[model samples]
Target chain A: MAAPESGDGNNGAARMVTLISSDNTRFEVEAAAASLSQTLQLTILDGGGGGGDGIPLPNVDSATLSKVLEYCIKHAPAAANGGAPNATAVDRAELERFDNEFVNIDQSVLYSLIMAAHNLEIEGLQSLVAKKVADMIKGKSPMEIRRTLGFPDPTPEEQAEMNAHMLEYGWAYE
Target chain B: MSGTIGVTLEQSRSRTAGPVLPENHVVSEILVRLSAKALLRCRAVCHSWHRRTSEAAFLLVHHRRQPSLPLVTFLAAASSSQSQHSHASLDTLDLRLPPLIGVGWTPLPRLADAALYLHGSSGECHILRCKRRRYGDHGLTTNAPAYHVLTIGSSAEPRRIELASNAPRASTWWFRCSERPGILLHGCLHWALHSSPEKLLMVFDTVTESFRSMPSPITGTQERTQLLEMDNTLAISWMDMCETTMRLWLLQDYETGVWTLSRRIIFPVTEMRSVLNVKWCRFYGTVVSQERYVLLHDSHSSYLFHCDGEGKLVRKFCWSGAVPRPAGHIGSQRASSGMSSSEGNMVLVRGDNHVSFKASRV
Candidate 1:
């Protein structure tokens, strides 16, 4: 754990700090709030920052990190508010809408999010990303699967083996 | 656009120093996208990936995702004794089984000098046996043997066959049992080895030739034994001690070749006097009707309350109402009707219902 005093002082809320991405771009956020990412949480807890300085994230580039932080900012509040008391019909609909919109992403960004979520121990993000990938590839043939995932073509023998084994699993309905 | 090579000084360095992830990252990315079959193939790609994909839990989870197809039963029969001219006397009743639709009983193949058994489904039959010879007193016999078991009706051919004869030129296939011989069910095979009277049940494999010995799940002190099938699930009924209650056992798992206990259904034992003779009480197979109702009858006119899946008596009526036979008496009925599929249903024989009629169908 690095001491918070080592970081450059940006905002002094005593409970908030700034996160500097790999590109040196900085965003002010509550220290308790930025700890949503398990990776960041450990670093912040060990660093002992009274929210007087900004922490540096060398691995996460500015654009992807900013998108991740935006997700945290929106989700952190509702979770802190103790979630839904009785889960009314309207609350369920609103949460569903928010989840749907939050998961929309391009392929590269989605892949990056999955990797980051896995590294950061973010359960919600990991499931959303894995489910999205599974849904896209379901019912697709091997060739289509390769194309969709940008996988390289297999050798002829490898292709033949796959076809033989998957003979029973192929769905005629699709 | 500015990040392209040679477009700007900063872009050129960025392109040269960019992090290129290893092939494993790509492999991981591809793994989650593969189908169940595709995932299985992914193992041959490398040893590490193969170990991960072949985990039993993973295969079970993957298999659970697929829809469960209707199970097909496979039955095989073979003669137990070496009697050359005599065939084992057996009676096969194709009662109006509801789960099975069409059925007019087809005459099974006559036993040759060799062992013989027949397997059937709906309207089809297949007789599987090893090649054997039947010699005439005139000393006439064929020098060659038949290679395959003849098809009696509609069942598929056996995957393999064996002729266990001792002729110098005879070739036999592999089929072995170290202890007791196995019992063949409608489409499955089972072998029951008894450690004691209490621990008696059978174990069998539906797909493989391997035999498993299992313990019976029935609680003893039951007066009589009854076995019932509800949608491929086997339920056994027996009377508990004191002859005042009936205990029913629903089988839970069949994969391990064991009849696991699922539920224990109890009923207040009904008491009735026998009209013909005051014999001991016994249990028999249940007769389920088209209305999804199960009618359980004991000896004589003693009819008990009818129960559904939940053990609740849906209705109780005089046993004579269902059958025109007189109450408090044992009577035999013998009338064979041409069994049809839809409109013309065959009458089920009750209380020692015997089928002595020959099949009119060839």
Candidate 2:
């Protein structure tokens, strides 16, 4: 699929891009938004294939693909708008609020986001997802945390072993 | 075939979708970063994760990432010179390990007064008193005060022991020391001893069964020794003889030769009566914790002293003393000495103000 490029005919602004997902889906995103992914941008630029073929992203599904695009779109504007001429506190506050809302999804979706961000080399998004998952289990008990993480049940002997290990190695004596 | 396909699509649509990341990898990654408290919680969630995290190897790995360094203390009979002895000649216990749990403590080997040194993986402790016998006019003045050492690891076994000093007469003992009443500080056992000459502080290593002398945190300033252990840090409180002013000092890590001067806590000294003669003046004891150290004064008054990562005192609480103290405190009747244990948050012992108690940190 051919990605559409919208820019004034200028030497420095002419850039092309392509994207693909794990399920054989292709996305023809603008170079501006596609460039948000350093991995994809570097790959395309290195290949020197301008306005040619779709970018192959063999890991992301369409649902996650759209979400990544939304983030790229939101972030691209700020980068293109001269870094918001000193981002206002309100603007930062709004961004924080949006990020919180964005991560409010179920753990399954969050896991997908982590994978997509990692595969796409979106460091900021990947860290956000990892931190969010960490925060979710911060205060939870081992059992609740295990259940939340969908861990299997331990056998009686294994439980004993764990308890013994904690007794032997744990530093709770402080 | 078309009807079957439609039914299959409907069934797939109705199923609830869970996150797509492989459960094993994600679970392991988070478990690696969880704190002790959080990990404890995670243990209860399910059997599989609990088993995985409860392994000594896994917990050790986690501990390596974030270790818990505790300050062990001890209590013993004080000597006449007002100085503590080394635990180099006594048995030792190894209290140091990879971080595994929170606030849990393990007792090191305990030794008697006449031992050499104690060394352990966590740290080393030594007896701080010397046998002093004055012989002149009155037959023989046997004024040698007694003291002991409680170390972190078992020193009875053959291990490369580290001695605190490069003194020429470095000796080693084989007998295992009895576990006395005191606290563990920085993995070494600490105790207090009282005698006619003066008070003494005792520390011992459990691993190498060696010992060394612990110098006063307040080196130059002459202060009545009153020690406490908060969290894994040591809080040594004293009153300068010259000014009768109170002060607190912290030993960050004796193994690393780190001694930090904590905030100075001054008490009012009146001229009507000798400040040193006050029996109840030494009733406050402090116990260090993760963020704040609890100070028990007059066997009732509880104050909190906050500390930073460097073990520097940062803040204090001004809550009034609690009524009818939770613990009993009795001073010696005659030239009786008072003692305070920083390990278990024991209240200050009135009367004899020289002897310090080393309670277990757990």
Candidate 3:
């Protein structure tokens, strides 16, 4: 499908594309925004996702796809500017604030977002979510981390091994 | 919390029940963002985390991802009047914390009898200390230097490594082991030895705990030079005392020891005079942060200049009269010298004075 030139004439109209999520939810977004995902960039560049067929994302659910698109749309302009060397300080700060707020979601949503971002090959989203997870893991003990990550109670043998490790690395606890 | 002690928590309680565990690659990504100490603590999380974190591949990835904050460890005499007894201390200017007030100075346990001097540290925070054997009433029976490597907070005792017989010995006052910190790269720590008529690079492989020497990139130059690690490769930077020119050479091929002259920078006469009023001064340069900036400090003065790779001045900082100098120390001879860390942080060590500057990108 050939992308129809935007009618604005100066820079052409913003080209829009349709993305179909796994659960059959359809999200219409700007082509530039959807192209932020390296996986989708190729298909979009090949003139896919421009028509009624819409690009299908089998690995990502509707909710996760929407969340990922929100990030791509917010970051697309800066990405298009080749890292936005000319971006104003306010512009950069706004994006940073947007990013921090974007990841402030439940752990379950964050996990799905991480998986979707990875499958879609969205570099910024992957890094943001990974850092969030790291923050949650920092400072917590192994048992706390196990609980936070939702691990089952340790078996007696596993508990014995953990106790031995704690004895060996007692300084870390201090 | 007591009621929950023996209860088996189901996966559904976890905020996300998609999978019991994240993929190994995802876990590695998260692990890389953690600090070294935090990562060590995480080793007890599970057997899988322990095995993954211990892999050499994961270490390299973590080193690359984490910012290299320059930390300075030095020995300070117990008192200004008494130079005999000293204690070791470490301080780091962590930028992740708030500016100016984030200095962490921890006094390390004192080494018994012998004076311990900091030689260098690896990116993994493995510190190498040289125990200078002091002669008492017994008189000098053995003068060989003793070396030890230990990580901070590690329960394992520091292990001593025997220096090879062929290792260059410091014989003269002027040629005391180069004040520069060891350059850690490629699983080895490298130090430049200033031997008369020839300067040799001494390398210690952290893996094998063996010592070997390699020829300096530029030989037979009377100019002062320092060895530094840049972009995972060994680099040497030297200043021409006669002229205001600095030459940087990088060992492009470690296996072949082939050095390519990467950059030749000429300092402006005015900028040079601002740092040093004298006509001739010894300056040592180290490439900081992806070869973008080179940090140069005058041997005799506390003034430090941060310049671009091309030798243009970006900014200048001076410790000047405020820096506590050991009494009777002559010339611009500093007890310790400054080194650039992986992320462009400048670490300056002299006697008890340890200062680190967060890299200001120009």
Candidate that would win on TM-score: 3
| Cα lDDT of model 3 by residue, B141-195, tens digit | 5454566765433456777877667766633212122234456566666666643
Candidate 2 chain B: worst-modelled 10 consecutive residues by lDDT: B328-337
Kindly give the number of clashing pairs for every candidate: 8, 123, 2
lDDT of model 2, residue B46: 50
Which is the better candidate, 1 or 3, if ranked by DockQ? 3
What is the lDDT of every predicted structure here? 0.41, 0.44, 0.59
Task: Give the alpha carbon lDDT tens digit for every residue of A1-174 in model 1.
Answer: 222322224344335667887788887776545766777777777774345567776666777777777676655545444554665788668766877787787766766666666656665566666667766655656555545655445557756755664563232213
Clashing residue pairs found in predicted model 3? A6-A13, B300-B332
Candidate 2 structure quality by residue, lDDT tens digits, A18-90: 6766666766666766666768777755663245567766668877887887777666545545556787888
- Model 3's CAPRI class is acceptable
Work out the TM-score per prediction: 0.41, 0.44, 0.59
TM-score between model 2 and native: 0.44
True contacts kept of each: 0.01, 0.35, 0.41
Winner of 1 and 2 under lDDT: 2
- Cα lDDT, model 3, residue B253: 86
State the weakest 10-residue window (summed lDDT) of model 1 chain B. Answer: B328-337
Best candidate (score: lDDT): 3
Scored by DockQ, the top model is 3
TM-score of chain A of each: 0.77, 0.76, 0.91
The C-alpha local distance difference test score for the whole of candidate 3 amounts to 0.59
